[model samples]
Each structure stands twice: as C-alpha cells, then as structure tokens.
Target: MNFSGKIEYWEQSTNGTWSLFAVNPSDNFSVYNFCGKFGSCNLNDNKLPCKCLPGFMPHVPQKWYSGDFSDGCTKNLMSCGDTFLNLKMMNIGRKPEQSHQVGNETECKELCLKNCDCSYTYDEKSCLIWTQELVNLQEEYVEGYNLSIRVAISDIEPTVQNCEPCGTNMIPYPLSTSSNCGDPMYFSFNCNTTSGQVSFKALGGTYRVASIYQNTSKFFIQVMDVGSLRLNQSLPFNLTTPRNSSSNVSSRVTDDVEIVWEPPLEPLCNLPADCKD
Candidate 1:
C-alpha cells in the first residue's frame, strides 16, 4: 500500500486493514542555522520563530521585520567593550571550535579573550570556546546549559550607580551586588567583607575581580581553583554575599585574566609575499 504523505508511515493490520504506524517528524527542523548567525530559533514560536540575542540588533531590520532572518544580528557599535553577558539555559546548537580542560572558569574566559576571534565560552565539565560569528543559538527553557557571550560593559543595563568600593578596588556600576550598588540583568557579583575581595559569579565557577577600568570599560579577574560548578543556580538571579564574616578565606595563586585586549580586526598581510611590500 502507498502512503499519502512522505512523513506518515502506514502498516497493514492483522485483519488486512492498513493503519497509521509511525511518523518521522524530522522534516519539521532538518536545517541547521536556519535562522542564521546570532539568530535563535524558537520552535514554540510559530509566528516569529527567530529572535536576536540580547545586546544585538538585526543586521537588516527590514529583512528581520519582514520575516527573513538570514542576515542574523550585529553587535551594537556603542556597546563595544570587554564585559560579558550570561545567557543561561540555552542550546548553542553548534560545537565550539576549541575545547580544552582548564583548571576553572576564569581560565576559560581568559583563553577565549586571548583569541581575538573567540566570540563566547561555555564551561561545564570542560571549557568550550567558540570563535567567529555564532549561529544556531536556541533558548532551551528546560535542562539547558549556561553560555557567556563576550560583550561590552555598556551593553548590560545599569541598575545601580556609584557602588560601594570592594576594599581598595572600586566596584563599578554594573558589577556590584548591594542594592545600593547593579545589573538587574543578572550580573551576579559578590563582595567579601573580611578578605575585602570582590568576586564575579558564573556557571563555570567564581573568580576574583582584579581590577575595573571605567574609562576603557575593561575588567581583570583572577581565575580560582575549580572546587564546584554551580550548574543548578537559577538564571537572572543575584548571588548573595557570604554570611561568614571571618577573615580566614584561604588564599590561592591564580592566573591573571585579561579579556579586553584583542588582535587586529584585519590581517596585516594577505599572503607571505605581501609582507615584503
């Protein structure tokens, strides 16, 4: 017997009547990066299935508004800097170009920063780094992994201003935890009262904030040992300060985290012979 449609499978019953057997629904979503770079496809959304990531605007708004998402998105020019935005519970649909087993989350961030092409970093059991334009990012509401995209500090919305200082170092507007201090967008940071050190919290782990530069919008954090991976922490939530007020916080040697520096956007030479000219 012939089936009416390609997706429906029919099998003959014992009595001789043919009935529906199984359906292969793979046709619904067979294309990868169907929404293009920086565009997230929402299977739940039928009317407008594609959306741009936070801090991103459609590369061609006209095309996006017209329901053509091939152009994807582009970073806001005014928002260029060295901070990061945490997109939790997401399906990054593509495998990273580089994967390494690092000591902790900070090392992953540092590794990505060292590569100018690196766009984002994901740390679970291993540190995963992606380079160039990212594509096929989907929001998996349930049982999804955490992703941190490199963004400018200005890209994050400001809630608290003139935050209280974290010891000798000052806590900038978007990196503070005190209500008096800010990224209502879930920029989680912790200030240690006893040790007087400020820490930045991420899915991979936590790291110490070495310094913050307001003029250039840059941050230097020190990577710590990976004791725990806080995978269960809810997204868009603040990390409460440690209750213990003692000064016995153990000190460990950490590598310096420099995420602001980047390589030249364009190659210096097209070929080896071009260098001679």
Candidate 2:
C-alpha cells in the first residue's frame, strides 16, 4: 500500500481484504523508528519528536532541526569532573565496552569515575561501564535502567533541605508542602490524606513519590493515566517517555517517570574567589 510518499507492507485478511501492516518512519518496527544515536524520541511531543540528552547538544544543529538526527549529539562541555548526571529509564540498545562486578553502587560509581574514558555506567545485579561515546540512548517511559553520564561539576547544584514529611515521601528543601517550607520560586505540593493513602502534586499533576535524590534534586514518581497528563515545557522538571510504546494496547498500565528539577546554574558572581578568573 502507498501511504503519503512511502510504501507500506500490507496483508490480506480472511475475507480477501487488504490491510495496512507497516510503513517507514511511522511504523514502530522500522529502523530509526525512535531517535537516532544520542537522540531520544518522544511520540507525545508533537513539536519536537527527538531531543538530545542533557549536557549534550546536536552535533549537526541544522540537520537536527530539519528532523535528521543521523549525526546525533556532541557534549556541550568537554571537560569531565567529579559529577555525573543520572538519566533513568533509558533504553541503550548496545552492550557496555567493559563490565565489572562491584559490591555496591558507590563502588560502581567510583570505578566509572576513575576511568577517564568511561562515559556511562549502570549498577543492578552487577556494574556495567561504557568507555566509548554513548549512542542509541533512548528515554523510556516504562521499564528501563539508569544510565549515569559523566558531566562537568559546575553544572550540578548542591542539595538543600527544608520541609519534613508528606506521608512517606520526604519534601526536600527546594520542594515544599507549604509556602513557608520551600523556596518561593518553586511551587508547593498539596498532600491529601482523605483516602488514607498519601499523595501529592509534583507540579500540576498528582503523583505518588517513589524516591527522591537529595544531591541531584530529582524525584522518581508514579502517575496514573499518563496519557491524559499534558506536560508543561516551561516547568523545571523533566519527564521520561514510556520504555515500550503502548500505542496499540487497549488497556493502560501504571508506570514511573523521573521528574528532575535543577535550579539555574550559579552565576559567575556566586563562584568562590579562587575559582573565579
């Protein structure tokens, strides 16, 4: 069958009727169906289908804006420091260049840091490290593993504490349950206990806080009916897409998305005396 400007494969039904099977670009099975190397594809994002991972910029900006991600992305800042940003629920469709058996996550982190060539690392049952340029790293909305990418230390903001508790979820300093609790620049969360189950609004939508990273100021949240949630791009938080596309599924399932809010990078005036030029 011909669809738009592309040809698609079709199958004949029992009644001898032809039905569309797959088409290039639109079909999920096609090569480069998702994003290209280092470019993440979000089907929900009608305006921007592909985006570069944090701390990286499109290698060929002109081509990327024209919907060509074959060149992928390049690191915005080249110098690697002690800090690494954790991008959770990522589908990296390749094997690590090196694998190690580490006792704990801390050891896994240290191993990756010591190697200047290491660009990514993962710790589950064991530690896996990648010493080459990361590619085909897709952000998954459903199930996936965390990929820590080496970043410059200047990019990270120090963690702070303020509020106490909203059920089991701890309200960190920058994020508060009350106006008096957190920074006014950031919004407040409303904790509802009417159902005897604690739940709060991360920004505009309701979610159950799964985990909080104090150092990174990131939250792992589980939201129901994610399809209905319209994400606001102006907000500081970042949302992950479902790992596997459920476009054809009739029923919806609960999934977790990582929400991270980082305060703007500190100004040059805020830098320490010795660190300044």
Candidate 2 lDDT, 1-277, residue by residue in tens: 3646567778999999998987655543234524566566543322234666655678888998787777877666777667676665566667888787877888888888887646565556488888776665554445655677776644332233254343223455567666654555446356543211124454357765545655787765555566755555665667766433234321243555666776743323333641342
- lDDT value, residue 5 of candidate 2: 59
User: Could you report the Cα RMSD, in angstroms, for every candidate shown?
Assistant: 18.4, 10.0
lDDT of each: 0.57, 0.57
| CA displacement after TM-score superposition, residue 210 of candidate 1 (Å) | 38
TM-score of every model versus the real structure: 0.48, 0.56
Clashing pairs for model 2 are 140-241, 141-241, 141-242, 141-243, 142-242, 142-243, 162-173
TM-score for candidate 2, residues paired by index:
0.56
Reference-based TM-score, model 1: 0.48
